[model samples]
Target: MSPKIHFISGLPRSGSTLLAALLRQNPRFHASMSTPVGSLVNRMLEAMSEDNEYSVFISPEQKRAMISGIFSAYYQPQAEKAVIFDTNRLWCSKLSLIKELFPGAKVICCVRNVAWIMDSIERLVRKNSFDVSQLFNNPTERATVYTRTEALSQGGRLVGFAYNALKEAFYSEESERLLLVDYDLLAQNPEKVLSLFYQFLEEEPFQHDFENVQYDEPEFDNRLNLKGLHKVRSKVELQQRQTILPPDLFIQFNGLSFWTTPSNSLANLIVAQPK
Candidate 1:
């Protein structure tokens, strides 16, 4: 059987990494930490002084070559079930090229509330992964630019962009196979959410332990402190006020809030009580 490919798309710090880590524990699945394709593409763009266009001009032959190389390099041949999960934040931005590479693959969109996502990203900036100097360069230009900050602003604007892109894909002749999973639900009811994921991939659920899933802790030592990062993010949020996202994206991704509600009977079921 041809290897199954699952594309995990979402804002950074929105739990895609956690999901990938959990999925990798299953014997049948082969998942990698965020691959170099995106970073490579970004470097290429910076080198060319152009926006993302590496995949745009690539011929069909080249596209196949690149995808095959990525697969062979990242995926282990011994994986029993042969499902390859590509966890990349920029995959959604390059949906067209990704489709060309893996036509039969299933797209799994992970979403979260914009505010919380921004808060998380702000924390990330404190860790020094992004340059805070970009925030002050040009607010309008920066808003349109794809900084790690813009990716984290999980509110309406980012969701709207993703929604419109997915809508176009689904409506297009090429997209009958995309699935969306809420990040909050996955965190709250991992077993149930993962069961659905397994069913979607047509794989038998493995009897694996979820409690031991290793997740990296958020670190802070970058340019901005928590207070400074939030202040800058607040400024960006103000500039983004007119670009609100659709309500459905929020509804679909806000499952975490619902699961946390007192009356939801399952509230305590999957939640880990603090010691």
Candidate 2:
């Protein structure tokens, strides 16, 4: 049997990277930011679904297993005993498929206010003074706050697509399989929040050194003009950050999160696996 694995998917810049970095501190865990599992599945479906001669030769079952084979191949390098956490935003959209592929797998979604999610991306873009971000794939297009806001929320970007997909998973029959970890809660009280997460995953406690965590992907960051995009803090404590976005602009996406609403029964749930 393949080794156990779960998924880390949620709003970009909402701490998924930090969560993965922390999880990897456990020698028994294998975790990383935005792994290719989701993308591989998407690419395979795109190629095989075409109405061509090759399409007739492949069965649906074969395709499914092949998609899973990608995961098996990617994680084959890890110790056979390690539990994996594959991170990707597209995982949010494939709820039914993921449930079938990894029956007991839980998706940990790091969330902040929608407005702030947008704000975080914008802040990074602004930080790269000379290098325009390839975030939207238009490096030369210097986007303003208003224009960027529209573009992010309207298209294939993280905040828009994944946010919608999360809502779908939250309301599905598999809603119990999703955990929404708020950025503020994770920032201010990681121990409390992560305890719930570990409990949900049914993992034994690891003596995580919150005081010293290090992660960076400078090459990947440079490709996108985000030099320090993947940098993680040495300490897990919440540091004060005043949003560069205006109050009016930031408020636009404040209430977009369902977790903060009264009807959100799954808010901050530690585990979504069935008992």
Candidate 3:
């Protein structure tokens, strides 16, 4: 049987990494870290330093080979029954490329509230954990505070882009092969989420002890923070009642302004019932 490929995508800190790590625990799954081709292309562009002239120099064939190379290097020869899972946010930005690379791969798009995701990203940057500013900045280190701020503030838009990309991909592809998992729902009912996930993969769910599942705490790179790049939480609201809702309905559905937006104040007016 051909190796099964699974692509997991979502905005940063939306629990994509945690889900990837958990999926890796399954004996038949080989989930790897984020390896976005767009990110690689972005890096290459930065190296070239040709403003507005830099294009995707790598041909489609080369891009496909690069993705195949990642799988062969990391997952090949592991086990025949093992499925390869690439948990990369960069893939979210290049859904078309990903679809071209793994023609029949299962796409898993994770969803989370835009406000919470933005807040989480803020915490990550403040702690100097993972710097995604490189994607939007040249020399990465020279990334302005506004660039960093915009990345977090535009969580809804990012999620929307990913969702729309996946939607378009699925529109022209098989419907049974794509899955969307909500982070909040999974957090509330992991067992239910896992059951649905297993159903999607057509795999038998097994009982495993998760009491000792060791999750590594994210470490902050103090060296990066030493540059006096202090983290500042913005008070900007994400919801402004735009003309069109972002393509990613999940992002907008799950409360548009949880942490930073003033429009979310209306959400607080709703009374919560006792569970």
Per-model C-alpha lDDT, please?
A: 0.53, 0.79, 0.51
Off by over 4 Å in 3: 36-67, 77-81, 125-148, 154-176, 217-275
On residues 107-185, what C-alpha lDDT tens digit does candidate 2 reach at each position? Answer: 8887777877877888788889788767664532356777677777864775688788777777777777788887777
lDDT of 3 by residue, 1-275 (tens): 75777777645445565566567677887664465534555564354444536435666566557556655665556648457777765554555555666766666766655545544544445544444442243444336433444543443444445545444443443434556565655555556777778877777895533333333322222343422222211221122233222344324444542222332121111111212
**lDDT: worst 10-residue window of model 2:** 266-275
Which sequence of candidate numbers ranks them by lDDT, best first? 2, 1, 3
Q: Which TM-score value belongs to model 3? A: 0.58
- Model 1, 101-176: lDDT tens digits are 6767776766555545544544444454345433333544345224434443333344445544544543444444
TM-score of each: 0.57, 0.92, 0.58
Clashes of 1: 3
Q: Rank the candidates by TM-score, best first.
A: 2, 3, 1
- Model 2 residue 274 CA deviation (Å) reads 28
Model 3 Cα shift for residue 11 (angstroms): 1.8
The residue ranges of model 1 lying beyond 4 angstroms of the native Cα positions read 39-59, 76-81, 124-175, 217-275
